[model samples]
Target: MRIIISPAKKMIVDTDSFPPEGLPAFLPRTERLLSALRSMSPAALQALWKCNDAIAALNVERLAAMDLSRSLTPAILSYEGIQYRYMAPTVFEQSQLDYIRTHLRILSGFYGLLRPFDGVTPYRLEMQAKLAVDGCRDLYAFWGGTLAEALAAETNLVVNLASKEYSKAVEPHLPASVRFLTCTFGEEKGGKILEKGTACKMARGQMVRWMAEHGIDRAEDLRNFDGLGYAFSPAHSTESNFVFLKGDT
Candidate 1:
């Protein structure tokens, strides 16, 4: 089984804690992206990032000095966001780390698809960003079927924990033989399932930790997940889409 999640916008470079396994599989494609980004002025970059002055300035500097080969951090440790914070990889045991290395994947705008231990530099780009590259108008177009092909090479079962934006880069192109399952976390609100952004992020992270802790390898076994007050809801779930609903704690 393989699980895919989105990379966080916020990041920190820490190579000391865990040694990076190797470069990202899509390094060549990443270079093509960096080449386009590097050519943009700070103002243009600011527009592309769509951030305030300070954040844009930081990334402008980051892009200017970005080196794909050196000063890299593990992809898992590099990301710092709500989902990643809830996942809490910093305190994970070695066995859990091993499990993650084998099963977990982080989808990125720059790197395409990244293994947990894949070496990466700090950069800011979202899969939905409209930055045109080559003739492609968006990241999804630029990535094409590459990400899905990579996952298909690994396993037949893919549990998608990634959000719609990043997951679009892979889901549409997956081979017909691949069994793609999307996990949904939400609450029954006014008789309808409502997915709150923060709640879903926390749930996704917690679910990943639960899988690692239990060494879960089968998609069906994911129904056993019970983290952060969530419980698998057969009423709202299907074989292709697993739904976990949270009630009042």
Candidate 2:
């Protein structure tokens, strides 16, 4: 059955008021990456954080400096940068490396799902890319809305699939317009409202139109939609709705 939502305004999640528990297990490597980064000079790190070029340089530096071919952890770290660009790693010495690489590919491909390329500033994009590598599922969870919320110290909206029980619990509490976030047609190749010109066939114009009819303005307004999980703003009145009709055609 199709579902429609019409939130009067953007549904706000008082992130500070209702913070999530610790990060998920699927995100330990991400944690390690962040921890490792913390050891670097704050000034350098901040520069890197602010400059895309610096971030790219850091990524290149890490891969070149680390011996990924020798161990599982190193290989995983090395693959992190490669995956952000949606490129697969040429080397995989361990099963763990292979596993991590698989996830990275998903993230890179789903890059569009996080935000429209143009809307996400280069610095924010770089930050998200780095955050993706940090074994932080909460960041990965709906394009890291909570993570973003924490970082910006402000409330943020996230969209995810409704199939899970967790979504069910939150659905009723959300505003009517934003009940259903964006629909994910597929993985990696799915819909990413966050990224512009990065939409998949299933999440193309038709989906956007549907959102407009319900309430969604800029494509960037779409946080994430993987068919299974979704999140979006219930405020910013545009259109409110959910679910993709381009299924099993």
Candidate 3:
């Protein structure tokens, strides 16, 4: 399982050949909605950045507990080369990873309302795609507001993804300064899996167990694995949040 992380979408980990389907499906919609946002527009992505930064700030203590798990869990990645299986070497890099992880978590939370967190399942992918479309729409509208309102609106709106009455629930919560935009990417283009085999049959928990069986405990070990690569953040949400805040501030 070769995993490659690139700064290009904030540590996007490519497991086989492409991002999960929901993300790709959602990408073009988001792009079309947010067409006003130029490529890699800092202003456009800032709300997302602030939300992640806030979460990392809350994750500090939770992060400490995770190092212990790394020692106990040797099947996921080989922790032998890394000082702590769950941690990045420098605080800086850790923050980068955390920022990405935190936002992904928020995204997951949203989809959780409608689907399970199945990495490649059709339903999960579809829900993720919907979120990608909806989220970018809201985020782009945020820039017209004061920075604080924009950040708050982005966070709360994203949180709403999991809401049962997202449309009604979010409208009251959103700052009036922000408005939804329309964006699209890829036009629901199909994707290819360059990897030789599939990990689609494996549930996320099963995949983790498989990794543990191999005594793989660090992020780097996936480089030699034959299937997919996953980017992980410790389960401790609070600690992840602390890391987010420390880095973004």
Candidate 4:
């Protein structure tokens, strides 16, 4: 089984935590993306990133000096979003780290797909970015079925903890033989499931950490997850989707 999640927008360079195991699987494609990003002017890049002047300037500087094959931080240690912060890989035990390294995958627009320890540089392309390349209109089109094929090659079961944008890269193109299970973290109110972005991010990260700590492999076992006030809702869950709701505690 493989667990797939989204890449965080905010990132940092942390060489001290752990050295990257190796380059990403799609280095050549990433090289092309780098070239295309390099060709864009700062104004255009800022537009693509959809950020304020300071954030855009920072990313612009990063893109200017970015190198795919040089000094790098492990992918799992680079992202600084709330989800990653909650996952807290930096303090993870060695066994938990090993478990995630074997099971977790990060879906990306810049690098395509990344293993937990894959060496990566900071950049600003999202899977849903509108940057067109060659004849492809967007990142999703460029990635196509590549991510799906790679995951299907590795395992027949996929646990999707990623948002719709990143997961679309794989889930839509997956073969029928592969079992794709999605986990939803939300609150049940007035007979409706409402998900707040920040809370869901926290839940996703906590869930990843919990799964790794327990070395969970089977999809059904995930129903036992009760991290961050969430409890599995059998009424809301189906064969392909697992719903966890946070009630008044």
Off by over 4 Å in 1: none
What TM-score quantifies how close candidate 3 is to the native fold?
Answer: 0.20
TM-scores for the candidates: 0.98, 0.23, 0.20, 0.98
- lDDT of candidate 3 over 1-249, digit per residue (tens): 111110111211123432222222233333343343233244334443343644443332223232211122111111111112122212224344333333322221112211111131111111112223434444323222322232353353221111122233233444644332110001111332121111221222233233334544333442233322333222312310211111111
**Model 2: CA > 4 A from native:** 1-145, 148-180, 186-241, 247-249
TM-score of 4: 0.98
Model 4's alpha-carbon lDDT is 0.92
Expressed as tens digits, the lDDT of each residue in 123-147 for candidate 1 is 9999989889989998889999999
Model 4: weakest 10-residue lDDT segment is: 240-249
lDDT of 1 at 115: 94
- For every candidate in turn, the CA RMSD to the true structure comes to 1.3, 18.2, 21.3, 1.2
Residue-level error in angstroms, candidate 2, position 112: 15
The digit string of per-residue lDDT tens for model 4 on 4-92 reads: 99999988888887799999999999998889998999999989989999999999889888888888999999899999999999999
Candidate 2 lDDT tens digits, 83-181 = 122222222234533332222111221121121111111111222323333454332343334322221221124343222322332344444333234
